[model samples]
Each structure stands twice: as C-alpha cells, then as structure tokens.
Target: MKAVTIRTFGGPEGLAVIDVPVPAPAAGQVLIRNEAIGVGGVDAVIRRGTLAMYGFEEGHIPGSEVAGTVTAVGDGVDASWVGRRVWAFTGVGGGYVEHAIAAVEEVFPLPADLSAVDAVTLGSSGMVAHFGLAHAHFAPGESVLVRGAGGSLGIMTVQLAAHGGAGAVAVTTSSAERGDRLRKLGATHVLDRSGQGGGADAPAGYDVIIDIIAGADMPSFFAKLNPNGRMVAVGAVGGRPPADFGMAMMAAFQKSMSFATFSAATVSEPDRRAVRTAQFDAASRGELRTVVHELLPLEQAALAHRKMDAGEVFGRIVLTP
Candidate 1:
C-alpha cells in the first residue's frame, strides 16, 4: 500500500508519498481501497500545524474523507460490506492512501449512478453545507445571505438556500467570475467580498446570514441582518479574525439578532446521517452541485493543499489514488 504521510509539520511539501504495509481493519472497522479523496481548507490548517495547540502529532495522514470500495471487514462487521462501493469519513487523518481503514459505522453505501469522484467532492460538500445551515432555519420567502460564498461550502449554502425557498438570496465573494456563477446558482444579488449591502436593493435585508468568512468584516455583516435575524459562522478561511467581544455585543444589541457557530461534531450521529442522505439525494437529482476546481492524482495532494491555502480553489478538489 502507498500513503501520503506528514513526517514533519510545516507546509504542503511535508506531505510525502511512501510505501507501507496494507493496514488490516480492526474490530468494528473496514479496510477500503480508496478511489478518491476530499481536500479542503482545514487540511491546510492541519498541515500548517495550527491544530498542534491541542496536540496533533506528526507522522499522521492528512485526509479526512475518502470514496472507495470495501475490500475487507473486521470482526463484528458485516461481511456483505466487502466489495461495496462507499464513502467514509476517515476522521482527522488516514485517508491519503491507496487503502485506508474506517470505522464500520462511518461507511456510506453509494448510489449506482454516483461516481467516487462526485461522492467525495460535491457529495461531501452538500452534506457539510446541509449540516452548517442546520444551525439556523429561515422561513420561506425570507431574505438570506451566504457570506464568503465562493468556496465549496459557500457554494452549497447558496444553492440550498435558494432551492429551499429563500425569497431573496445574496452572496459575497472576492472573485467576479465566482460571483457570476453564484448568481446562476440561485443568488438574487451578489455583493463584493468586502461590501456590506451598499447600493444593492435588499428586501427587509438578510433574515439569515450563513457566514464562512468571519474576518474583520463580521461587524459590518452583523449590521446588515434584519432585527431578530440569525448569523451562523461556519468558517474562517481568511485566517483567524480578531474578535472584539464588546464590538460584537454592541452590534447584536443594535439589531436584536442572534449569532452562533456550528460544527459537525455538535450534531448527533443519527441527525448527521439523515442530513447526509437527503443532501446526497438532492445532488444526484442535479438540484445541488459543487464547483470542483480540479481532480488531481493522489501524488499531487500537496499541490491541492497549496491551492486551497492560497484561496485559489473555488470549490471542492478531489484526488484520485
């Protein structure tokens, strides 16, 4: 077996491919021959050793998701799982390889029409976007905004909000080309990445704000939300933004709006699976889509990480093994 390992933590170059013995599945786990892998901004963060504050050690793999065929199942696992095409969340690492192990419970059987590339890229993004928006709900005909709506998560948020009955969908992005795509994806208005409504016509303003870039522009966005509205911060792709408690509280007071942050870990296992299933079905029907920038080979995993970290990636980047 071959796997990309991070023997040292510093930059993307640290991701080196090496030969290793095929790992056998432990009890309640399954071994998969990976067909594709999912790469996102968080992978870069981990690569840069940001998570080391909590003790992330070196020699760990960097992939979080993989789509492949199960070659073997461990004790207490169903033998029928063998040879099933599926995608599994290989939590925290251990996915940048030809074959990886995943807990049996994490594996999801794929639909016949779904390709491994699509499952690991767009399919995973849809599930994440669904889970992120689960933090707050907007009523039908309500105004909605997807802040920093240029990345994979942002793209999904914009599409789902529009398809789910948002009367007005607004988005913010740095790329003009991406802005145009967002409009086509269901956005009624597209604002510049730093713009806070400005001359744009907003109907009662944004009733719900799905923010991925909670940088210095946050306070300005907070001011745009309608009274009693909610703003959910789901990402910080623009590096860590300094949060001044007093300033945020003042903004909240001005509009009587609520603010929260969501993570997949906050949701129960059953709820997560339900959301993943619904989003996957929606994607298969062509209702939800991912803006895949490229599908590179597993050997170029480091290059994918570089692009993602540089903000050059617009959507999901899949790596095939």
Candidate 2:
C-alpha cells in the first residue's frame, strides 16, 4: 500500500510518499480502499508545526476525511458493509493512504447519486457546519453573518443558513473573487474584508454570527450581533487567545447575546449521525453542492498541502489514490 506520512514536523516537504504494508482491520474496525481524501487547513497547521505540540506520533497520516469502499471487515462487524461505499471522519489521521481502517460506527453509507469526490470533501467541515447552524437555533426570518464565507466550511454555513430560512444571510471574504462566489451560494449580502467600504458601513445587527476567523476581528464581529443574538466560533485561522474580552462583554451585555465555541470532538454520536444523514440527503437532492477547487493524485499530496497553507484555493481540495 502507498501512503503519505509525516516523518518529521516541518513543512509540506516533510510529508514523504512511501510504500508500506496494507493494514488489517482490528476488532470492530473495517479496512477501506480509499478512493478520495479531503485536504484541510488543519493538515497544513500540523505540517507547519504550529500544532506539533499536540503530539501526533511520527509516521502519522494527517487526513481526517475519507471516502472509499470497504474491502475487509474485522471481527464482530457485519459483512454486508464490505462492498458498500462510505464516507467517514477518522478523527485525526488515517485518510491519506491506499488502504485505511476505521471503526465501523464512524462510517456512513454514501448516497448513490453522490460521487466520491463530493463525499470525501464533506468530511468534518460539512458536519461542523451543520452542527454550528443547528446550535445557532436559526428560526424562520432570522438573520446570520458568516465570517470566512469563502472557505469550504463557510460556503456550507452560508447555504445551510439560507436553506434553514434565514431572512438575511451576510458573508465576509477577504478575497474579491470569493465575494462573488459567496453571493452565488445564497448570501444576501457579501462583504469583502480587504476593502474599507465593504463591512465598514454594513448593518450593525444580526440575529446570529458564525465566525471562523476569530482573532483580531473578534470585537468587530461581536459588535455586529443583535441583542440576544448567538455567536458560534468554529475556527481561529487568523490567530488565537484574542485580545481583551471586556469590549465583547459590553457589546454582548448590551444585546443580551451569548458566545460559544465548538470542537468537533465534543459533538455527540447521535448528532454526528444526524448531521451525516442530513448532509447526504441534501447532496442527493442537489441542495448541497461541494465546490472542489482542486483534485490531485495521492502522490501529489504535498503540493495540495502547500496550496491549502498558502490560502490560494477556495472550497475543498480532494486527493485521489
């Protein structure tokens, strides 16, 4: 079996393509022959060593999202899934290989109409978006503001919020190109963070704010929420441990709003199953569209990591084995 493994924590160059024996499934696990793999920003963070202290043992495979066919089923597992097409969240690793093993419970059958490319990209990002939107408790006619609306998760957030009956959906992107994409993805209003006029004169209140980039802009995002509104923090791509929270509290107090952060690991099993089912249903109906920015072979995984780290691509990038 061929796989990309990080022998050392450094850059994309650190990921070496090597031939290794195919892994056999353990008890209650299934071995899959991977067809497609999702490349995420966190993979880049791990490669760049920003997240190195988290302690991923050497020779680790960095992908969490995978879509493939089960080739072997382990003890105590149903054999019916052997030929089934599935997509799964492997948590932190084991998706960047020709053959990978996953616990049977973590796998979900993919819709017949959806392709491997789309299903692989849905991975954690789509699930997280579904979780965040549900947490926002969006009611009919409520409004939402999504920061980083150009990224893969941001695009899903925009579509889900609009589909859930949001009265107004506002999205912010630092790239002008992404502004156009966000509007097409159901954003009622698009703000370009790079321009002074984009978000500067925008409305000051929204019922919900889904912030993916939560660093220097925390204060500004807090100010945009309406009284009693909820803000769900999903990512800190810009930076972490944001400066003073006094101003945010004052703003929140004025509006009686609440702020919360989500880690995918904290989501319950039932919720995870619900999210996967809902997302696949949406995909089958053509309601959920995955924007694939690039697709590369498994050997080119390092290049994919570079592109994601440079922030030059939008939507999801998938790797085929």
Specify the highest-TM-score model's number: 1
lDDT of 2 by residue, 169-202 (tens): 8888767678888888888777766212345545
List the pairs of residues colliding in candidate 2. Answer: 227-255, 228-255
lDDT of 2 at 26: 88
Runs of candidate 1 with Cα error greater than 4 angstroms are 196-199
Over the stretch 1-321, how does candidate 1's per-residue lDDT look in tens digits? 778888789888888988999999999999999998988767777777877886777888888889999999999999999999998989888889999899987888887877888788765567667766667777778888888887888888888888788888888877677778888988888788775442446554678898887766677777777888888888766555565733775746867888888777777778767777776676677767756789999899889888877778877888998
Q: Please give the distance, in angstroms, between residue 277's alpha carbon in candidate 2 and its true position after superposition.
A: 1.6
Candidate 1 matches the true fold with a TM-score of 0.93
List all candidate RMSDs to the true structure. Answer: 1.9, 2.2
TM-score of each model, in listed order: 0.93, 0.92
